[model samples]
Target: MPFERVRLERVRLEPWKRRPELAALALLLGLLMMLHSHIPNIAGVGSLVESLLPWFGVYVPVLLAGALWRRSPSAVVALVLPVTVWLSLFGGLLTDKSHPGGDLTVVSHNVGAGNSDPSGTARQLALSGADLVALEELTDQARGTYEKGLAKAYPYHEVRGTVGLWSRLPLSDTRPVDVVQGDVGPLARTKPPESAAEAAAEVRALRTTVATEHGPLAVYVAHLGSVRVMPSQGFWTDSRDFGARALTKAVAAEPNQRMLLLGDLNGTTDDRAFHGLTSRLTSAQETAGNGFGFTWPAAFPIARIDQILVRGVRARSSWVLPETGSDHLPVGARVSW
Candidate 1:
């Protein structure tokens, strides 16, 4: 009878040994969790890996479910590493909350430039009832369309370069900020001529301040340079890294006590890229949101690239708005003094 029991135990463990894929996945999960902080600076590869980390939380559970289905003890134990890592990173998001908070309402959206239907996007954002709206990736051609579509609801608006801020409250002291795109001398000299016949368009970074009822709130709207993937290295997310650093320095220098930053940062708060902003401000979603709140490539949002960050304010509630024509989703948050 003892010999028979040993045989049964060995038989039960044999299946896990045969399924190498499960073991390999477990090993990969462990490595990712252990080395997450040491990820290389490769452009495309890095961004792709960083973007996929949040999804790992789901993958680990699915793998564990498969292990249970197969009755593999080895696989079941292997899942614990990733399960612990994922839960440690995002466990708090699972808790139930009655509501977030009550002072201010803010929204952020990328509003893809190639969007076939700007009017639809505008309508969706306007209906969100956000007190302030920040939009990025605004092209010259589509600017008027958005302005016209949003004018009725957001009476006060400001546009600096490619980014714009529209507010129901009066906006004042708006100005463009130099975000270290390139040589300042050449960029300044290349400006368009005063006369139409000799005019030539020039590139410049976008920034602005909005005067809100809460007080003079300095709002910064930015669309950082995109990171791309390549075969040689892995992924390239450096442009965003540099842009984030520059934006951070600028924000630090600003004298305003109440500040709000909204943008398609192209990275999550977990990423070190936003350390400058994250360290100083409270993420609205983190404080008051209910779910993962992913908001990129509308076909399937795997990450939350768009964000609403605040300093010297309180967040009451936050949520992702319904999708519109743009490839990105809109994120909104309500805050109080």
Candidate 2:
């Protein structure tokens, strides 16, 4: 009966019924990644999924390993679905797209308010060799330090609210764009700052135009409302999402065609919340960086919340700068007119 036993083992290994559960899971993962936007945002599930979507490809290999262990031919073949979907979505990010030089080099950083050494951070930024540097979360105590520290490198600078732009070039039409979506959501109960300066210090977005040899390049520096996970509320993103929508309106009214948006947007281009902004601007990191340029929780970054997006400008190269004292790393990009 050795021949019969061999036939049974072969049949079990080759049949679609073997490891059917694994096959189904493979299909599910493929569809989930492909149609993540339609997953619905109840409890911020959709945002969470899309924010970490690129990492979902990790499951494909796990499933493949399981299939191999089980010796299920059907399961191994089914893994192809998720693999293809994953490569289609994130394969482009695997290669280096950065070019050698460009007309402008801009760097954006959140510069955590809780950063212990603002002066050190400023010094690092000044020596970073950027034509323009945009900073967010400028506390009252650190503002002067940054202005002084970045002065030698960047002769011209402008600060509107907590957002500021320090540039080697001239700046004009400087103003703050309010991104507060009323007093609702997670920040509804947040206490107001002590004085007018403090209140202004609390503001998180600004718009300014830079005088370039080619033309006027409008630059926006923003730090959208923060997000968090709550046991009771699931993935809490009300504040961040509201801020994104408000920022979208301001961008929609922008007059300049050549524009550069730099900041810790508090969300990635992968997240659907930035759809309006992404539709208008191209992410420098996504277009030119070698890999996923994650810039958050500086110690070990997993998501790319900081961004340098441009319109009517070619992003020749993109990269992440060395760690500063802040919680988020700096993102730099070279753009040409």
Candidate 3:
């Protein structure tokens, strides 16, 4: 009887001693999150991985379940590595950071060009109570609708190419920004003698100075090139990364001290491609928002591709607005000089 009992105890202990592969995988996940920046951008896959990096946390529960089912003590102990790493990376975002009032409220929305109801989207934006609004992906037919719909609340507005800015205050020094990767600024930004349709095709970014009571606030509106993923091409970020590099140069050369960039940057702040932008400007959502504040795919947001970055102002609060006809959701930020 004693020998049989000893054999049964050993059989039960076998599982705790096995499944080293599970423990190894847990450690690998930790390393991936901890040293994600070190991963090369080979074929832009790194950017894609980093873009959805937050979702990596989902694996924690998955692995935990496996560990429990397998009765592997090593795997259970290994889970602490990934859990700690994930919390360290995004733990701050799990908390609320918003404060009360602000000097100005700004909203950025990439109203999809395929939108069926531009007028309705415009009406919703007008009701957002934003002092300034930046819009992207505006089609020629819908441009007039937005202009007319927002005329009452926003007296000053500028439309250059597909991007536009509407402000309750006065606007000046407004011009298109040539965000073509290697294109020279002076030549690229110039609206040459071309048809309105040609201008719309060529321009996707703009900058303007809003005359506020406190002082002049330089605002930049941009819709960087889109990204795509394919089985053959993997993460195709060539155009978007090109635009990012060019936009970084433009932001570096900006003379205004109080500057803000509002747009659909096509990637997250964690993306290495936007290191230049993130290094200089701070994201309002990350600074003062309630949560991850994902603003893409209005039906079910999963990532925060849209951004409101400030250089010389304080972001008091940030939030995502109610969905409109557009595919992308509108993001708002409250700021003070």
TM-score against truth, every candidate: 0.83, 0.93, 0.91
lDDT of 3 by residue, 1-337 (tens): 6999999988877745558988999999999999999998876778988999999999989998998888888988998999999999888899999999899999999999999999999999999999999999988889999999999999999999889999999999998898753543223345463686775567889989999998999999999888877566677787788789888988999999899999999999999999999999999988999889998888998899999999999999999999999999999999997
Report the lDDT tens digits of candidate 1 across residue range 1-337: 6999999988867654436678678868867965676776444444466667777777777888787777677777788888887778778777643274576788989899888998888888888888888898888889899999999999999877678888988877777665534422212235435763232112123555666566777888877767565455445566667678888888888798788888888888878677788888888888788887899878899888888888877777888888888899989888777
lDDT of 3: 0.90
Choose the strongest candidate by TM-score. 2
What candidate 1 gets wrong by more than 4 Å, as runs, is 1-27, 43-47, 69-71, 96-101, 183-205, 231-233
Per-residue lDDT of candidate 2, residues 1-337 (tens digit): 6999999998877743477988889889999988988999999999999999988988988998888887777888888888898899899999999988799999999999999999999999999999999999888889999999999999999887778999999999998887763746655737766798766866789899999999999999999988888888899888888889988898888989899999988888989999999999999988989999999889999899999999999999999999999999999999997
RMSD of each: 4.8, 3.0, 3.9
Where does candidate 2 clash, by residue pair?
none
lDDT, model 2, position 139: 84
Model 3 alpha-carbon drift over 4 Å, by segment: 1-15, 181-196
